[model samples]
Target: MTPPSRPKLSLRASLFGRFSLADTGHDLRPLPQQPKGPISMVMRLGAMGVLLGRTTRLVFSARTDKGDTLRLAHKFANGSAVFIVVAMSFVGMIMVYQSTVQLNRAVGDTQLVGAAFLKLLVRVLGPTVIGMLIACRIGAGIAAEIAAMAVTDQLDALRLCAADPIEVLMVPRLRAGIIAALSLVIIGSCASALAGMTTGVVLFSMSPSTFWNFELIDNADLVQGIAKAFVYGVTVPIVAGAVGLSARGGAAGVGRATTDAVVGCSFAIVVLDSLISLMSHVVAGL
Candidate 1:
Protein backbone atom coordinates (compact mmCIF):
# COMPACT_ATOMS: atom_id res chain seq x y z
CA MET A 1 0.00 0.00 0.00
CA THR A 2 1.20 3.45 -0.81
CA PRO A 3 1.46 5.81 2.12
CA PRO A 4 -0.27 9.21 1.92
CA SER A 5 2.03 12.06 0.93
CA ARG A 6 2.87 14.64 3.65
CA PRO A 7 1.67 18.20 3.12
CA LYS A 8 4.22 20.97 2.69
CA LEU A 9 4.59 23.39 5.61
CA SER A 10 3.68 27.01 5.03
CA LEU A 11 6.57 29.49 4.84
CA ARG A 12 5.27 31.34 7.89
CA ALA A 13 5.15 28.17 9.97
CA SER A 14 8.61 27.10 8.76
CA LEU A 15 10.03 30.49 9.70
CA PHE A 16 8.52 30.35 13.19
CA GLY A 17 8.97 26.66 13.91
CA ARG A 18 12.38 26.89 15.53
CA PHE A 19 11.12 29.27 18.21
CA SER A 20 7.79 27.53 18.84
CA LEU A 21 8.95 26.11 22.16
CA ALA A 22 10.86 29.22 23.17
CA ASP A 23 8.62 29.62 26.21
CA THR A 24 9.12 26.01 27.30
CA GLY A 25 11.99 24.17 29.08
CA HIS A 26 12.32 26.85 31.73
CA ASP A 27 11.61 25.95 35.36
CA LEU A 28 7.91 26.38 36.08
CA ARG A 29 7.96 25.10 39.57
CA PRO A 30 5.28 26.65 41.77
CA LEU A 31 6.14 27.71 45.30
CA PRO A 32 4.82 25.83 48.27
CA GLN A 33 1.18 26.20 49.22
CA GLN A 34 0.02 28.94 51.57
CA PRO A 35 0.96 28.53 55.20
CA LYS A 36 -1.73 26.98 57.35
CA GLY A 37 -0.06 26.99 60.75
CA PRO A 38 1.81 29.30 63.13
CA ILE A 39 5.19 27.84 62.21
CA SER A 40 4.49 28.08 58.50
CA MET A 41 3.37 31.65 58.93
CA VAL A 42 6.57 32.45 60.79
CA MET A 43 8.60 30.85 58.03
CA ARG A 44 6.78 32.84 55.36
CA LEU A 45 7.41 36.03 57.31
CA GLY A 46 11.11 35.18 57.50
CA ALA A 47 11.21 34.56 53.77
CA MET A 48 9.60 37.94 53.15
CA GLY A 49 12.21 39.61 55.37
CA VAL A 50 14.95 37.95 53.35
CA LEU A 51 13.38 39.07 50.08
CA LEU A 52 13.03 42.62 51.41
CA GLY A 53 16.70 42.65 52.38
CA ARG A 54 17.75 41.58 48.90
CA THR A 55 15.52 44.14 47.19
CA THR A 56 16.74 46.92 49.50
CA ARG A 57 20.32 46.05 48.63
CA LEU A 58 19.60 46.23 44.91
CA VAL A 59 17.82 49.57 45.32
CA PHE A 60 20.77 51.03 47.21
CA SER A 61 23.22 49.62 44.64
CA ALA A 62 21.40 51.62 41.94
CA ARG A 63 20.71 48.49 39.91
CA THR A 64 17.47 49.57 38.27
CA ASP A 65 15.90 50.76 35.02
CA LYS A 66 15.75 54.51 35.38
CA GLY A 67 13.10 55.02 32.72
CA ASP A 68 10.95 52.30 34.17
CA THR A 69 11.41 53.70 37.65
CA LEU A 70 10.37 57.17 36.54
CA ARG A 71 7.43 55.86 34.57
CA LEU A 72 6.19 53.75 37.45
CA ALA A 73 6.70 56.63 39.87
CA HIS A 74 4.63 58.88 37.64
CA LYS A 75 1.93 56.26 37.38
CA PHE A 76 1.86 55.73 41.11
CA ALA A 77 1.67 59.43 41.83
CA ASN A 78 -0.75 60.46 39.08
CA GLY A 79 -3.08 57.52 39.47
CA SER A 80 -3.28 57.86 43.25
CA ALA A 81 -3.14 61.62 43.71
CA VAL A 82 -6.78 62.39 43.07
CA PHE A 83 -7.98 59.60 45.31
CA ILE A 84 -5.67 60.63 48.10
CA VAL A 85 -6.59 64.27 47.83
CA VAL A 86 -10.33 63.72 47.89
CA ALA A 87 -10.32 61.16 50.68
CA MET A 88 -7.93 63.11 52.82
CA SER A 89 -9.78 66.36 52.26
CA PHE A 90 -12.96 64.83 53.56
CA VAL A 91 -11.07 63.22 56.43
CA GLY A 92 -9.58 66.54 57.38
CA MET A 93 -12.92 68.31 57.35
CA ILE A 94 -14.58 65.62 59.40
CA MET A 95 -11.76 65.53 61.93
CA VAL A 96 -11.83 69.28 62.37
CA TYR A 97 -15.58 69.36 62.76
CA GLN A 98 -15.79 66.54 65.26
CA SER A 99 -12.87 67.64 67.37
CA THR A 100 -14.02 71.24 67.41
CA VAL A 101 -17.51 70.19 68.45
CA GLN A 102 -16.25 68.02 71.27
CA LEU A 103 -13.83 70.59 72.54
CA ASN A 104 -16.38 73.35 72.30
CA ARG A 105 -18.89 71.29 74.26
CA ALA A 106 -16.38 70.54 76.95
CA VAL A 107 -14.57 73.85 77.40
CA GLY A 108 -15.94 76.29 74.78
CA ASP A 109 -12.38 76.74 73.63
CA THR A 110 -11.51 75.60 70.08
CA GLN A 111 -8.69 78.07 69.64
CA LEU A 112 -6.02 75.41 69.66
CA VAL A 113 -7.90 73.03 67.37
CA GLY A 114 -5.98 73.80 64.22
CA ALA A 115 -2.60 73.54 65.85
CA ALA A 116 -3.39 70.21 67.47
CA PHE A 117 -4.98 68.78 64.33
CA LEU A 118 -2.04 69.82 62.19
CA LYS A 119 0.34 68.24 64.64
CA LEU A 120 -1.58 64.97 64.52
CA LEU A 121 -1.82 65.10 60.75
CA VAL A 122 1.86 65.75 60.37
CA ARG A 123 2.93 63.10 62.82
CA VAL A 124 0.41 60.27 62.50
CA LEU A 125 -2.70 60.74 60.38
CA GLY A 126 -1.30 61.80 57.04
CA PRO A 127 1.36 59.16 56.53
CA THR A 128 -0.70 56.29 57.93
CA VAL A 129 -3.67 57.18 55.78
CA ILE A 130 -1.52 57.60 52.69
CA GLY A 131 0.27 54.34 53.36
CA MET A 132 -3.01 52.43 53.64
CA LEU A 133 -4.22 53.90 50.36
CA ILE A 134 -1.00 53.04 48.57
CA ALA A 135 -1.06 49.56 49.97
CA CYS A 136 -4.53 49.00 48.56
CA ARG A 137 -3.81 50.63 45.21
CA ILE A 138 -0.19 49.77 44.36
CA GLY A 139 0.35 46.63 46.37
CA ALA A 140 -2.38 44.71 44.56
CA GLY A 141 -1.08 45.87 41.18
CA ILE A 142 2.50 44.84 41.89
CA ALA A 143 1.40 41.49 43.21
CA ALA A 144 -0.94 40.78 40.32
CA GLU A 145 1.55 41.65 37.58
CA ILE A 146 4.44 39.79 39.14
CA ALA A 147 2.33 36.82 40.23
CA ALA A 148 1.09 36.37 36.66
CA MET A 149 4.66 36.37 35.43
CA ALA A 150 5.70 33.96 38.15
CA VAL A 151 2.95 31.46 37.38
CA THR A 152 3.69 31.65 33.66
CA ASP A 153 7.39 31.00 34.33
CA GLN A 154 8.37 34.32 32.84
CA LEU A 155 10.55 34.90 35.90
CA ASP A 156 12.47 31.78 34.98
CA ALA A 157 12.82 33.01 31.41
CA LEU A 158 14.34 36.23 32.71
CA ARG A 159 16.74 34.16 34.80
CA LEU A 160 17.70 32.13 31.75
CA CYS A 161 18.35 35.38 29.86
CA ALA A 162 20.83 36.32 32.58
CA ALA A 163 18.56 38.97 34.06
CA ASP A 164 18.08 39.22 37.79
CA PRO A 165 14.35 39.53 38.38
CA ILE A 166 14.99 41.43 41.60
CA GLU A 167 17.19 43.93 39.80
CA VAL A 168 14.91 44.22 36.79
CA LEU A 169 11.44 43.88 38.23
CA MET A 170 11.63 44.84 41.89
CA VAL A 171 14.24 47.58 42.13
CA PRO A 172 12.52 50.08 39.86
CA ARG A 173 9.31 49.65 41.77
CA LEU A 174 11.06 50.14 45.10
CA ARG A 175 12.62 53.38 43.90
CA ALA A 176 9.43 54.60 42.28
CA GLY A 177 7.45 53.76 45.37
CA ILE A 178 9.69 55.95 47.49
CA ILE A 179 9.27 58.89 45.17
CA ALA A 180 5.53 58.45 44.93
CA ALA A 181 5.16 58.15 48.67
CA LEU A 182 7.07 61.32 49.38
CA SER A 183 5.30 63.34 46.70
CA LEU A 184 1.85 62.08 47.53
CA VAL A 185 2.34 62.60 51.23
CA ILE A 186 3.20 66.22 50.58
CA ILE A 187 0.28 66.72 48.21
CA GLY A 188 -2.17 64.90 50.42
CA SER A 189 -0.99 66.71 53.53
CA CYS A 190 -1.60 70.04 51.84
CA ALA A 191 -5.03 68.99 50.70
CA SER A 192 -5.93 67.90 54.21
CA ALA A 193 -4.67 71.17 55.69
CA LEU A 194 -6.60 73.26 53.22
CA ALA A 195 -9.73 71.25 53.78
CA GLY A 196 -9.41 71.53 57.52
CA MET A 197 -8.99 75.27 57.24
CA THR A 198 -12.04 75.57 55.04
CA THR A 199 -14.10 73.54 57.46
CA GLY A 200 -13.01 75.68 60.35
CA VAL A 201 -13.77 78.91 58.55
CA VAL A 202 -17.13 77.89 57.12
CA LEU A 203 -18.61 75.66 59.75
CA PHE A 204 -16.95 76.77 62.95
CA SER A 205 -16.85 80.47 62.03
CA MET A 206 -13.14 80.48 62.82
CA SER A 207 -10.74 82.68 60.90
CA PRO A 208 -8.43 81.07 58.33
CA SER A 209 -5.56 82.64 60.22
CA THR A 210 -6.55 80.76 63.34
CA PHE A 211 -7.27 77.47 61.59
CA TRP A 212 -4.04 77.49 59.58
CA ASN A 213 -1.84 77.70 62.65
CA PHE A 214 1.39 75.71 62.60
CA GLU A 215 2.31 76.29 66.20
CA LEU A 216 1.87 72.68 67.39
CA ILE A 217 4.05 71.12 64.68
CA ASP A 218 7.83 71.24 64.61
CA ASN A 219 10.80 69.79 62.74
CA ALA A 220 10.44 66.54 64.64
CA ASP A 221 6.86 66.06 63.48
CA LEU A 222 7.78 66.78 59.88
CA VAL A 223 10.68 64.38 60.05
CA GLN A 224 8.49 61.66 61.57
CA GLY A 225 5.88 62.03 58.84
CA ILE A 226 8.46 61.95 56.07
CA ALA A 227 10.19 58.98 57.63
CA LYS A 228 6.91 57.09 57.83
CA ALA A 229 6.14 57.87 54.23
CA PHE A 230 9.57 56.71 53.13
CA VAL A 231 9.39 53.48 55.07
CA TYR A 232 5.85 52.72 53.92
CA GLY A 233 6.79 53.36 50.32
CA VAL A 234 9.69 50.94 50.45
CA THR A 235 7.63 48.34 52.27
CA VAL A 236 4.60 48.07 49.97
CA PRO A 237 6.51 46.98 46.88
CA ILE A 238 8.75 44.57 48.76
CA VAL A 239 5.87 42.81 50.49
CA ALA A 240 3.84 42.71 47.30
CA GLY A 241 6.76 41.36 45.28
CA ALA A 242 7.44 38.71 47.85
CA VAL A 243 3.84 37.60 47.82
CA GLY A 244 3.82 37.64 44.02
CA LEU A 245 7.05 35.70 43.61
CA SER A 246 5.65 32.98 45.80
CA ALA A 247 2.46 32.62 43.80
CA ARG A 248 1.48 29.21 42.50
CA GLY A 249 -1.48 27.37 40.88
CA GLY A 250 -2.79 29.82 38.25
CA ALA A 251 -5.10 32.85 37.99
CA ALA A 252 -6.68 32.02 41.33
CA GLY A 253 -3.24 32.04 42.80
CA VAL A 254 -2.63 35.47 41.37
CA GLY A 255 -5.78 36.81 43.02
CA ARG A 256 -4.71 35.23 46.27
CA ALA A 257 -1.34 36.83 45.97
CA THR A 258 -2.85 40.25 45.45
CA THR A 259 -5.04 39.91 48.52
CA ASP A 260 -2.11 38.69 50.53
CA ALA A 261 -0.03 41.58 49.28
CA VAL A 262 -2.51 44.21 50.39
CA VAL A 263 -2.96 42.54 53.74
CA GLY A 264 0.75 42.21 54.23
CA CYS A 265 1.41 45.78 53.25
CA SER A 266 -1.24 47.14 55.58
CA PHE A 267 -0.01 45.03 58.47
CA ALA A 268 3.55 46.11 57.86
CA ILE A 269 2.54 49.75 57.71
CA VAL A 270 0.76 49.59 61.05
CA VAL A 271 3.54 47.66 62.73
CA LEU A 272 6.22 49.92 61.39
CA ASP A 273 4.28 52.98 62.39
CA SER A 274 4.15 51.80 66.00
CA LEU A 275 7.81 50.84 66.12
CA ILE A 276 9.01 54.06 64.52
CA SER A 277 6.77 56.17 66.67
CA LEU A 278 8.10 54.43 69.74
CA MET A 279 11.66 54.90 68.65
CA SER A 280 11.05 58.56 67.90
CA HIS A 281 9.53 59.02 71.33
CA VAL A 282 12.48 57.36 72.95
CA VAL A 283 14.90 59.50 71.00
CA ALA A 284 13.03 62.69 71.88
CA GLY A 285 13.13 61.79 75.54
CA LEU A 286 16.86 61.19 75.38
Candidate 2:
Protein backbone atom coordinates (compact mmCIF):
# COMPACT_ATOMS: atom_id res chain seq x y z
CA MET A 1 0.00 0.00 0.00
CA THR A 2 1.16 3.49 -0.79
CA PRO A 3 2.30 5.46 2.31
CA PRO A 4 -0.42 7.77 3.57
CA SER A 5 0.25 11.29 2.51
CA ARG A 6 1.53 13.34 5.43
CA PRO A 7 -1.04 15.88 6.65
CA LYS A 8 -0.02 19.21 5.19
CA LEU A 9 0.61 21.99 7.73
CA SER A 10 -1.00 25.25 6.62
CA LEU A 11 1.56 28.04 7.03
CA ARG A 12 -1.20 30.60 7.55
CA ALA A 13 -2.84 28.49 10.27
CA SER A 14 0.49 27.96 12.07
CA LEU A 15 1.25 31.67 11.93
CA PHE A 16 -2.26 32.52 13.21
CA GLY A 17 -1.91 30.03 16.05
CA ARG A 18 1.42 31.46 17.04
CA PHE A 19 0.04 34.99 17.01
CA SER A 20 -3.02 34.00 19.08
CA LEU A 21 -1.01 32.14 21.73
CA ALA A 22 -1.25 33.57 25.25
CA ASP A 23 2.55 33.45 25.58
CA THR A 24 3.10 34.98 22.13
CA GLY A 25 6.24 36.99 21.71
CA HIS A 26 4.20 40.05 20.89
CA ASP A 27 0.65 41.17 21.83
CA LEU A 28 -1.18 43.03 19.03
CA ARG A 29 -4.22 44.20 20.99
CA PRO A 30 -4.55 48.01 21.26
CA LEU A 31 -4.34 49.69 24.64
CA PRO A 32 -7.58 50.80 26.25
CA GLN A 33 -8.60 54.41 25.63
CA GLN A 34 -9.17 56.91 28.43
CA PRO A 35 -12.70 57.86 29.41
CA LYS A 36 -13.79 61.20 27.97
CA GLY A 37 -17.06 62.38 29.54
CA PRO A 38 -18.61 64.58 32.22
CA ILE A 39 -19.79 61.46 34.03
CA SER A 40 -16.22 60.23 34.43
CA MET A 41 -15.22 63.57 35.86
CA VAL A 42 -18.14 63.47 38.25
CA MET A 43 -17.19 59.99 39.40
CA ARG A 44 -13.64 61.09 40.07
CA LEU A 45 -14.90 64.04 42.10
CA GLY A 46 -17.22 61.75 44.04
CA ALA A 47 -14.35 59.45 44.97
CA MET A 48 -12.33 62.44 46.13
CA GLY A 49 -15.27 63.58 48.18
CA VAL A 50 -15.58 60.16 49.80
CA LEU A 51 -11.93 60.18 50.80
CA LEU A 52 -12.27 63.67 52.23
CA GLY A 53 -15.40 62.71 54.11
CA ARG A 54 -13.82 59.63 55.66
CA THR A 55 -10.79 61.57 56.82
CA THR A 56 -12.96 64.30 58.33
CA ARG A 57 -15.15 61.76 60.07
CA LEU A 58 -12.18 60.01 61.63
CA VAL A 59 -10.75 63.27 62.97
CA PHE A 60 -14.08 64.31 64.40
CA SER A 61 -14.64 60.92 65.97
CA ALA A 62 -11.21 61.01 67.56
CA ARG A 63 -12.20 64.11 69.49
CA THR A 64 -15.31 62.40 70.83
CA ASP A 65 -13.72 59.08 71.70
CA LYS A 66 -11.77 60.35 74.67
CA GLY A 67 -11.77 57.52 77.24
CA ASP A 68 -10.60 56.46 80.68
CA THR A 69 -7.48 54.82 79.31
CA LEU A 70 -6.25 58.16 78.04
CA ARG A 71 -7.21 59.95 81.23
CA LEU A 72 -5.42 57.39 83.34
CA ALA A 73 -2.36 57.46 81.13
CA HIS A 74 -2.24 61.22 81.25
CA LYS A 75 -2.55 61.26 85.00
CA PHE A 76 0.13 58.63 85.34
CA ALA A 77 2.56 60.29 82.94
CA ASN A 78 1.87 63.75 84.37
CA GLY A 79 2.24 62.69 87.96
CA SER A 80 5.43 60.83 87.20
CA ALA A 81 6.80 63.68 85.12
CA VAL A 82 5.80 66.17 87.81
CA PHE A 83 7.54 64.16 90.48
CA ILE A 84 10.70 64.03 88.42
CA VAL A 85 10.42 67.73 87.74
CA VAL A 86 9.99 68.41 91.42
CA ALA A 87 13.08 66.44 92.30
CA MET A 88 15.13 68.22 89.68
CA SER A 89 13.71 71.55 90.70
CA PHE A 90 14.63 70.89 94.28
CA VAL A 91 18.21 70.19 93.26
CA GLY A 92 18.28 73.34 91.15
CA MET A 93 16.82 75.36 94.01
CA ILE A 94 19.51 74.14 96.35
CA MET A 95 22.18 75.09 93.86
CA VAL A 96 20.62 78.50 93.29
CA TYR A 97 20.27 79.04 97.03
CA GLN A 98 23.85 78.06 97.65
CA SER A 99 25.01 80.36 94.92
CA THR A 100 22.87 83.32 96.00
CA VAL A 101 22.75 82.84 99.76
CA GLN A 102 26.25 84.28 100.15
CA LEU A 103 25.39 87.19 97.85
CA ASN A 104 22.24 87.88 99.89
CA ARG A 105 24.17 87.73 103.14
CA ALA A 106 26.81 90.06 101.80
CA VAL A 107 24.27 92.56 100.44
CA GLY A 108 21.52 92.12 103.06
CA ASP A 109 19.10 91.02 100.26
CA THR A 110 17.01 88.31 101.93
CA GLN A 111 14.34 88.17 99.12
CA LEU A 112 16.59 87.27 96.19
CA VAL A 113 16.58 83.48 96.52
CA GLY A 114 12.86 83.46 97.39
CA ALA A 115 12.00 85.33 94.19
CA ALA A 116 14.04 82.94 92.09
CA PHE A 117 12.36 79.92 93.74
CA LEU A 118 8.87 81.24 92.96
CA LYS A 119 9.67 81.80 89.28
CA LEU A 120 11.06 78.29 88.89
CA LEU A 121 7.95 76.79 90.50
CA VAL A 122 5.70 78.65 88.06
CA ARG A 123 7.67 77.38 85.08
CA VAL A 124 7.47 73.73 86.17
CA LEU A 125 3.76 73.72 86.99
CA GLY A 126 2.80 75.41 83.72
CA PRO A 127 4.50 72.82 81.52
CA THR A 128 3.25 69.88 83.62
CA VAL A 129 -0.40 70.89 83.27
CA ILE A 130 -0.01 71.52 79.56
CA GLY A 131 1.67 68.18 78.99
CA MET A 132 -1.02 66.25 80.85
CA LEU A 133 -3.83 68.01 79.02
CA ILE A 134 -2.27 67.33 75.63
CA ALA A 135 -1.42 63.70 76.33
CA CYS A 136 -5.01 63.04 77.38
CA ARG A 137 -6.62 64.97 74.55
CA ILE A 138 -4.49 63.99 71.58
CA GLY A 139 -2.92 60.68 72.54
CA ALA A 140 -6.17 58.89 73.37
CA GLY A 141 -7.93 60.43 70.41
CA ILE A 142 -5.30 59.11 68.00
CA ALA A 143 -5.43 55.61 69.45
CA ALA A 144 -9.24 55.43 69.26
CA GLU A 145 -9.50 56.91 65.78
CA ILE A 146 -6.90 54.60 64.30
CA ALA A 147 -8.30 51.55 66.04
CA ALA A 148 -11.83 52.33 64.84
CA MET A 149 -10.75 52.84 61.24
CA ALA A 150 -8.86 49.57 61.28
CA VAL A 151 -11.86 47.70 62.64
CA THR A 152 -14.20 49.28 60.06
CA ASP A 153 -12.29 48.18 56.91
CA GLN A 154 -11.97 51.76 55.78
CA LEU A 155 -8.30 51.30 54.99
CA ASP A 156 -8.95 48.22 52.83
CA ALA A 157 -11.73 50.01 51.03
CA LEU A 158 -9.40 52.85 50.22
CA ARG A 159 -6.94 50.41 48.66
CA LEU A 160 -9.71 48.80 46.60
CA CYS A 161 -10.83 52.21 45.39
CA ALA A 162 -7.27 53.03 44.23
CA ALA A 163 -6.99 55.93 46.62
CA ASP A 164 -3.70 57.28 47.94
CA PRO A 165 -4.57 56.42 51.51
CA ILE A 166 -1.48 57.98 53.02
CA GLU A 167 -2.19 61.43 51.67
CA VAL A 168 -5.82 61.19 52.57
CA LEU A 169 -5.39 59.65 56.01
CA MET A 170 -1.95 60.62 57.24
CA VAL A 171 -1.71 64.24 56.12
CA PRO A 172 -4.59 65.42 58.22
CA ARG A 173 -3.32 63.50 61.24
CA LEU A 174 0.13 64.96 60.78
CA ARG A 175 -1.28 68.48 60.63
CA ALA A 176 -3.41 67.91 63.69
CA GLY A 177 -0.55 66.28 65.57
CA ILE A 178 1.83 69.16 64.95
CA ILE A 179 -0.76 71.62 66.17
CA ALA A 180 -1.56 69.53 69.23
CA ALA A 181 2.10 68.99 70.07
CA LEU A 182 2.95 72.66 69.87
CA SER A 183 -0.01 73.58 72.02
CA LEU A 184 0.90 70.93 74.58
CA VAL A 185 4.55 71.93 74.67
CA ILE A 186 3.64 75.54 75.26
CA ILE A 187 1.29 74.57 78.06
CA GLY A 188 3.81 72.14 79.55
CA SER A 189 6.60 74.67 79.50
CA CYS A 190 4.41 77.22 81.26
CA ALA A 191 3.38 74.66 83.85
CA SER A 192 6.94 73.53 84.48
CA ALA A 193 8.11 77.09 84.87
CA LEU A 194 5.33 77.89 87.32
CA ALA A 195 5.84 74.70 89.31
CA GLY A 196 9.56 75.20 89.56
CA MET A 197 9.12 78.78 90.71
CA THR A 198 6.55 77.82 93.29
CA THR A 199 8.65 75.00 94.72
CA GLY A 200 11.61 77.33 94.88
CA VAL A 201 9.67 79.92 96.90
CA VAL A 202 7.82 77.53 99.27
CA LEU A 203 10.59 75.04 99.89
CA PHE A 204 13.84 76.84 99.10
CA SER A 205 12.96 80.37 100.21
CA MET A 206 14.04 81.90 96.87
CA SER A 207 12.92 85.43 95.95
CA PRO A 208 10.06 85.56 93.38
CA SER A 209 10.77 88.98 91.89
CA THR A 210 14.44 88.33 91.36
CA PHE A 211 13.70 84.87 89.89
CA TRP A 212 11.35 86.42 87.33
CA ASN A 213 13.90 89.08 86.53
CA PHE A 214 16.67 86.57 85.88
CA GLU A 215 16.61 85.47 82.23
CA LEU A 216 17.28 81.75 82.87
CA ILE A 217 15.16 80.50 79.92
CA ASP A 218 16.73 81.10 76.56
CA ASN A 219 14.72 81.47 73.34
CA ALA A 220 16.63 78.55 71.83
CA ASP A 221 15.69 76.22 74.69
CA LEU A 222 12.02 77.07 74.32
CA VAL A 223 12.20 76.54 70.56
CA GLN A 224 13.95 73.19 71.00
CA GLY A 225 11.32 71.89 73.41
CA ILE A 226 8.50 72.99 71.08
CA ALA A 227 10.18 71.38 68.10
CA LYS A 228 10.61 68.14 70.01
CA ALA A 229 6.95 68.13 71.02
CA PHE A 230 5.86 68.83 67.45
CA VAL A 231 7.97 65.97 66.14
CA TYR A 232 6.46 63.64 68.74
CA GLY A 233 2.97 64.75 67.83
CA VAL A 234 3.41 64.09 64.12
CA THR A 235 5.00 60.68 64.58
CA VAL A 236 2.60 59.39 67.26
CA PRO A 237 -0.58 59.82 65.23
CA ILE A 238 0.87 58.52 61.98
CA VAL A 239 2.30 55.45 63.68
CA ALA A 240 -0.95 54.80 65.54
CA GLY A 241 -2.95 55.14 62.33
CA ALA A 242 -0.57 52.83 60.49
CA VAL A 243 -0.72 50.23 63.22
CA GLY A 244 -4.49 50.36 63.34
CA LEU A 245 -4.82 50.19 59.57
CA SER A 246 -2.60 47.12 59.47
CA ALA A 247 -4.37 45.33 62.31
CA ARG A 248 -5.65 41.85 61.54
CA GLY A 249 -7.97 39.59 63.61
CA GLY A 250 -11.06 41.54 65.04
CA ALA A 251 -11.28 42.99 68.54
CA ALA A 252 -7.89 41.61 69.37
CA GLY A 253 -6.44 43.57 66.48
CA VAL A 254 -7.93 46.79 67.79
CA GLY A 255 -6.46 46.14 71.20
CA ARG A 256 -3.06 45.45 69.69
CA ALA A 257 -3.22 48.60 67.63
CA THR A 258 -4.10 50.75 70.63
CA THR A 259 -1.35 49.24 72.74
CA ASP A 260 1.15 49.63 69.91
CA ALA A 261 0.11 53.23 69.40
CA VAL A 262 0.73 54.20 73.01
CA VAL A 263 3.99 52.33 73.36
CA GLY A 264 5.32 53.34 69.96
CA CYS A 265 4.42 56.99 70.43
CA SER A 266 6.09 57.11 73.83
CA PHE A 267 9.26 55.44 72.54
CA ALA A 268 9.43 57.73 69.53
CA ILE A 269 9.04 60.76 71.75
CA VAL A 270 12.07 59.77 73.78
CA VAL A 271 14.21 59.13 70.70
CA LEU A 272 13.18 62.40 69.08
CA ASP A 273 13.82 64.32 72.26
CA SER A 274 17.41 63.05 72.41
CA LEU A 275 18.05 63.97 68.79
CA ILE A 276 16.55 67.40 69.32
CA SER A 277 18.75 67.95 72.33
CA LEU A 278 21.85 67.13 70.33
CA MET A 279 20.76 69.41 67.51
CA SER A 280 19.98 72.22 69.93
CA HIS A 281 23.42 71.98 71.50
CA VAL A 282 25.08 72.03 68.09
CA VAL A 283 23.03 75.02 66.98
CA ALA A 284 23.61 76.91 70.20
CA GLY A 285 27.34 76.35 69.94
CA LEU A 286 27.27 77.78 66.41
Candidate of highest TM-score: 1
Cα lDDT of all candidates, in order? 0.83, 0.50
Model 2 C-alpha lDDT per residue in residues 113-159, reported as the tens digit of each score = 54444343333333333433444445555666656765676654755
The superposed Cα distance between candidate 2 and the true structure at residue 157, in angstroms, equals 3.2
Candidate 1 residue lDDT tens string, 1-286? 9997654543222222221112233323232343358855675576567667667777767555589999999999999999999999999999999999999999999999999999999999999999999999989899999989987988879878877887898889999999999999999989998999999999989998888789888899999999999999999998898888777679998999999999999999999999999999898851
How close is each model in CA RMSD to the real structure? 10.5, 17.1
Provide the lowest-lDDT 10-residue window in model 1: 13-22
Candidate 2: where are CA atoms >4 Å away? Answer: 1-137, 159-163, 283-286
Best by lDDT: 1
Stretches of model 1 off by over 4 angstroms after superposition? 1-35
